[model samples]
Target: MTNPRFDVAGIGNAIVDVLTQTDDAFLEREGLAKGAMTLVDEAQAAAVYDKAGPAMECSGGSAANTIAVMARLGAKCAFMGKVKDDAFGRIFGHDIRSLGVHFDTAAAADGPATANCLVLVTPDAQRTMLTYLGASIHLKPADVDLGVIKDARVTYLEGYLWDPEDAKQAFRTAAAAARDAGREVALSL
Candidate 1:
């Protein structure tokens, strides 16, 4: 057994959120079901991005956000997820790292771009999400760093990762490592 190096290790989708403010009319015009998350392909993502007005891009995802918040609260955390060597990917990696969270997952050189979530917030404060999984879906068991998992006091997992077989394997690996180390594993549904 080794000394824990991190308070938590998170495994989940690495997504970049493109938030935009819109009205019900705009949501209806875009054929979006308000307040629901819909998965989109690359072409659909492009169409939505084109239709959306000015947007604010930020690093986001279920467990990813959890790790960022935990780190901000002064908890040592490590994040494991996949991204591409593209603009959004770079930004996502940089944002998490800048927050003092350890993220050493390798970026895919040749693949889809980083995942993008088009979050449309309406006047009622309700959000509608359109997501393109992109390279984040490429996360595999190999990306799960056993050392980081075992060295963390807890491992956090996101249920969204279940959509991808590889990512699901990575999540299981991390959880197993944490369990073997007698650490806690938390799942965010």
Candidate 2:
């Protein structure tokens, strides 16, 4: 029998998307590999932003995105991630909480800026992401809120979270907690 305190939990990179419509030539000029997520530093990320046309910002992180969709359906959710003390970071924080999801990770006072991904939707709707992991790299096992994991019936994680050691460990921590509580774990592709 499930404890049933909550419906679900999720974990993934805490990222914001800066979307831009671009051409293949632009990708070639920027030396970016098409349809792939390449890691870039703050300087490179800024440079790309400058080259890209007017962009729209949105709260998105793999696990967070899944949680967002679930929340839309009136399901309860929780998340774990790291952000900075900057404006974008605050925006990410508020949006998640406003949706009634619990986010308990502390912000890194001085590190890479909040994780931002440049999502390029080509004319064909093909999406290529260039990401700067930023403070999200700081999310560790300690950030995994075990109490929430124990309460939820289904805990969803993103496979891409494996890209970060800390996030991977955080998922492991959450997974362990879920198993201990006899809950189900699902990895979103």
Candidate 3:
């Protein structure tokens, strides 16, 4: 095969992170498990957001973060994930693209809002996270770009993506395409 067009192709959730500074009491009051990542529903996520202090929002996700770092390090990278056509979705796409990572997964026209994580940081520097999967969990096999997978030297899969059935199928599809193209498949646990 000809030389690969990209060094890595990453597949995983597309999430916007909202970080806030708070004390341990706040965590206790909110019933949040300090220093742990917990899955929350949309309502729960909103409740935490509403009750949190000043926050900083940014695009972040396991695979997306890895791809962003790789791109900054001069690696040609691509990312595949699902997001809704909402404000957070726009932010995620724009941020990743600005980092020189190719991200062309179509945003869902009608679905739950874009995924988000509420990160509460205590004085101790420990972070407690509440994540709402939302649209990110809607990634289906069709969302996986076979060409991107085949043209990347490595296809990276995020462990969290396996929780959703559709995303799992998409992950499998990407892995199969990479294997078929004689490329390596890497998983981040």
Point to the candidate with the largest lDDT.
3
What would the TM-scores of all predictions be?
A: 0.93, 0.85, 0.94
Clash number for each model: 0, 0, 0
lDDT scores of the candidates, listed in order? 0.91, 0.85, 0.94
- For residues 18-84, could you state the per-residue lDDT of candidate 1 as single tens digits? 9999999988998999999999998999898898889999899988999999999999999988999
Per-residue lDDT of 30-102 in model 2, one digit per residue for the tens? 9888899888998999899899988888889878988988888898778877889887788889888888887
Tens digit of per-residue lDDT, candidate 3, span 11-107? 9989999999999999999887889999999899999899999998888999999999999999999999899999999999999999999999999
Model 1: pairs clashing at backbone N, Cα or C within 3 Å: none
In candidate 3, position 101 carries an lDDT of 94
Cα lDDT of candidate 3 equals 0.94
Q: How close is candidate 3 to the true structure, as a TM-score?
A: 0.94
lDDT of 3 at 188: 92
